[model samples]
Target: MDLFFTIVAAFTIFWFTWTYLKSKGKPPSPPGPRGLPLVGSLPFLRPDLHSYFAELASTYGPVVKLQLGSKLGILVTSPSAARQVLKDQDTVFANRDVPMTAKVLTGGRDIAWNPYGPEWRMLRKVCVIKMLSNATLDKAYALRRREVRETVGYLYNKAGSPVNVGEQMFLTILNVVTNMLWGGTVEGEARASLGAEFRQVISETTELLGMPNISDFFPALAPLDLQGAVKRMKKPMDKLNAIIESIIEQRLKKEKESGSSSAVEFKDFVQFLLQLKDEEDSKTPLTMDHIKALLLDMVVGGTDTSSNSIEFTMAEIINKPELENPLVAIPTPRLMDPTLYK
Candidate 1:
């Protein structure tokens, strides 16, 4: 046991020292708060990471560099710097820096989180053409309009009752996303159950992504997995994957029973993925894991982002009461209210 401990200790020290020196050797990047020896600026990380980046950008010009443990991050706040990174050097910056939890939750296959490569290219192409292309998006606009109208009606009905508009908005967005992807809108008891499950998965995922993960910086410490973030993520990830699999299985069964080519017309994103899975053109046939990862990405990317933006806008409106009454009373059609539409 003593010999084993000594060997492990020596290896850990050597690995950390090597990583520190290698990172130090890189050409001088943008500057920000000087971090500690090993953990870097992890201690300063906040729930709203963007704000922290903004603060640093204000101090260190619009292009600020940050180190979180061993992970290096470049924050481009200025339009010029953003253009340089996103437009000019897009290929270099396109690759995602996948942390351990993302690898497990996404099965390392989610297009949004996947490294820039051929597989990502294929998935991106499919998403753009099949799901978000102008024609398909137009087809889905009616679904959005219906959901928005229903949500507005619900809010209008509760006008006198003190309601949590944020929660209502989140549910509204969640229902719209569910309907768009699954061909069904969650409601009442079912919505409560599904919303709980979805929230658990998304919360766990965001926590894992946003937390200052030490193992990601010092690979030697990965075995310890000190935070147990990885273990905690596994159960939620499994539950989410099972939910997606069940949905996919049900769709396939329905398609088989119908035995009609017309069923293709009713297909959603999952059906598009299933077709790609079987296509001979794919160099790597989409596996169950891949499909699940794609679904996870769609759920996370589609739902949380839209909901958060709505929440932010609503919060701003609530904070500024002077703009509220007029905005709410605008003569525009209920569904087309500029105050809420954008």
Candidate 2:
């Protein structure tokens, strides 16, 4: 019965898609696979998507058009084609078909998924001119150094125990990022627990973001959420948002108690953004939602990318000491006959 229902649904969907495409009269798309109307190429997709895509590129041209269920996928294989899409005519491809999970997390307000427009331009300006300026980063140098010292000390203390390099690096990087964003929002004993909880949430969030959601490939079925990607994402996303909200409230409370006129030192991005929110005289003023979204971007995007890079590099260095550079090596004696940063 279940199989019968699925088959009926697939046929219905194919008929609908066929009618829609026929009505549109779009130009001849790139040459590629002629998959079955019922399932398309979804069944043929291998677990290693990158290699599978490469295999397809070998058969088709650099630009391959794939019928992925209800969605049309255009795969760019060659560097020149990539350059044209990403650089030459970037505006044409600036907007992304955001997954259901990402929409839940950032509401398409964050820089990563926001479409290229005035608002996105304003966001870019805020991030670049405020958070990523040389002066801003220069101020953060002390925080990074301090976190490094603390991590090394902890490693020194736990000399005999088995240490997971990736996990430790994640915590270190996350702490540094959170401090830069909120300036000691979670303090003392709770900080350790927060790190563990945050890491677990982040790991789950990344997994959801990467997972192939039916909503992504079949927009008509998105509202149904047959896979529950959006549902699974909300808990962690909400927790992270709650944490950000608490930090914002605390900062706002401090402003109210101290009085806004009083000289409050801008030690972190939260304070800076709050101040900017009031003072911004632009046509599209920065709202609290945008501020929160950007914070989510940094926490989710920055820590994960940096930590994973460090983790992979450390693993390679530990495996073959010859690749160890003084800057990013693991320490000696602990993983003896191994190289770490000097």
lDDT of 1 by residue, 95-183 (tens): 87677788778867888777888778877887788778898788788878877776787777677898766566667777777676777
For lDDT, the strongest prediction is 2
Of the candidates shown, which would achieve the greatest TM-score relative to the real structure? 2
RMSD of each: 5.1, 4.6
Location of the lowest summed lDDT over 10 successive residues in candidate 1: 333-342
Using all chains and alpha carbons, the TM-scores for the candidates as numbered come to 0.83, 0.86
Tens-place lDDT digits, model 2, residues 210-298 = 99998888888899999999999999998999988998999899889988823865657888888879988888889999999999999
Q: Clashes in model 1: which pairs?
A: none
lDDT of every model, 2 decimals: 0.77, 0.84
Show pairs that collide, candidate 2. 329-340, 329-341, 330-340
